[model samples]
Target: MKVIHVGVGGFGKQWVRVLRSSRKVRVVALVDVSEPALAAAREAGGYNGRVPCFTSLQEALRAVPADALVCSTPPDFHREQVVAALRAGLHAVSEKPMANTLADCKAMLRAARETGNTYVVSQNYRYRPEMWTIAELVRKGGIGAIGQVRIDFHKGVAFGGFRAEMEYPLLIDMSIHHFDLIRFVTGLDPVSVQGTAWNPAWSHYKGDCSSSVVFELSNGCRVVYDASWCAQGDYCDWNGNWQIEGTKGTILYRNGEIRLLKVGPRYKVESSETMAPKPPPADSQHFVLADFMRAVKNGRRPKTDVYDNIKSVAMVFAAVKAVKTGRKVAVLDKDSR
Candidate 1:
């Protein structure tokens, strides 16, 4: 696939790295608001200067022939940039959050529909081995019916720029990853969400860096999300610690380990077995790009395609509303205003 890559800095650099390593992909053009960022991307990705650089995506699209446009811009830019690509007869692969708001996501989705072009949002966490394993177990009825899910996502880090300044940083910036995983692992759509966010007295961020978000799923399964970005001590891994309980069994995934246990009559463990995560065919962004490329080639919608991803984006906003209003907020859908 020939591609035009936008936003060549920060997470965008990682995307450039993945594109560079994929033999199936040829980056036809680079687009960034910063000329220095474009130069840095070429240097870091070992790209020859022959790959044309452009400060404007419009110019890049006209100058280069491409099969798809890879958009890694900030959330606020996603709607316009992705819509432009779709209108230009190019499939779009976008960074997560889809956009800063659900309304923007809908606009992008509308563009994809009107243009008849595939638009997929990159949701790399859904491709994890643990997530796949959990999905399989639920599909196979290893867990009769999901009842509840608990997640503890505590971390201490400082990634400056947009994240530090954003209000509800933990909920907006990080919790969406966990929220998407909840939707994927259970195969259940979120029905509603309620949550709260706060900043610790000694926290560095201007925004609240701690939060507890609760999601009520389609199957009446409740997912309680307890996460903190300004936490101290005993930091959980990025995937966080998960305990998914169902009618018959429970799956405990902490750090990188997975354990499945059968439930007895009175909530006692009837049996226990430890299982290693089966490796996914492709890892992280590699898997994401591979899926996107295949979808573009096949003229099919990719996994986490705009429509499917909108629900996850909605989950984030619903929680945001919940935090702000102090009430349960219903998750909206494609037809929502």
Candidate 2:
């Protein structure tokens, strides 16, 4: 599959590297507003031959004939770029939050439906090896009938630039990963949420620095989330921690280890196990790109397609609304139109 990458930022550069490493994908073009970013990505991407670079999406589209596009641009530009790609009859993989607003997400979904092209929102946390292993355990009833989950992501936003200036800040920019992960692990949709947010320290950021939320899932399970962009002291190595409590047991993951605490007829105890840190065979970016390529070849939808991502997008909007209103918001019914 011939692929064109839009937005050569830090994440965009990673996309180029991953796609280039994949045997199924060829990097046909790179687009970015900054010439320096383009040059840097070209170097890191290791494109020995001449690789087309463009300053504008239109120019890149004109220059590259691609089967699919990866939209790694800023959140605000996601809708426009995705619609453009779908209109051109190319499948699109986008960085999350899928768009700046619920309306924009809906529009992008509509465009994909109208164009009959795949629109995937790249929520990579679901693809993380440790997270995937935990998900499998949950599905196999290792922790039987999950009742509650807690996801916490606390880290200082070191990447200071346009991302810091965005209006929605942390929730829109980062929380989608956690929201998506909860759904991915439990295989449940959120029904409602209550949230609170504040920007106490990072005065430069237009959006909230910290947010706490609680979600009621459709299957009577509950999820609690805490996301922050300001961690004062030494940052945690992985930037987050997760815990799930089930009727029969509890599962927790932190610092690359997973523990299962189960209570049975014999005794109740904490059985802890650490996952060996095995780096991806190549890189995770390569895995996602390769998965997308195989899906395209076999006429299958990638794991993170538009319809599958709506729950995650809905969770984000629900949290934003809950923070603003200081009241619980129903996610699937109240937030989604």
Candidate achieving the largest TM-score? 1
Quick one: best lDDT, which candidate?
1
Give the backbone clash total of model 1: 0
Can you give the TM-score per candidate against the true fold?
0.96, 0.92
After aligning candidate 2 to the native by TM-score, how far in Å is the CA of 233 from where it should be?
2.5
Q: Which ten residues in a row have the lowest lDDT in candidate 1?
A: 328-337
RMSD of each: 1.6, 2.4
- Runs with alpha carbons beyond 4 Å of true place in candidate 1: 334-337
lDDT tens readout by residue for model 2, 109-219 = 889778888888887777767777788888989888988898888787665776678765888888887788888889887889998999876556777778899999988
Lowest-sum lDDT 10-residue window in model 2: 275-284
Candidate 2, 190: how far from true, in Å? Answer: 1.1
lDDT of candidate model 2 versus the reference? 0.80
- Which residue pairs collide, candidate 1? none
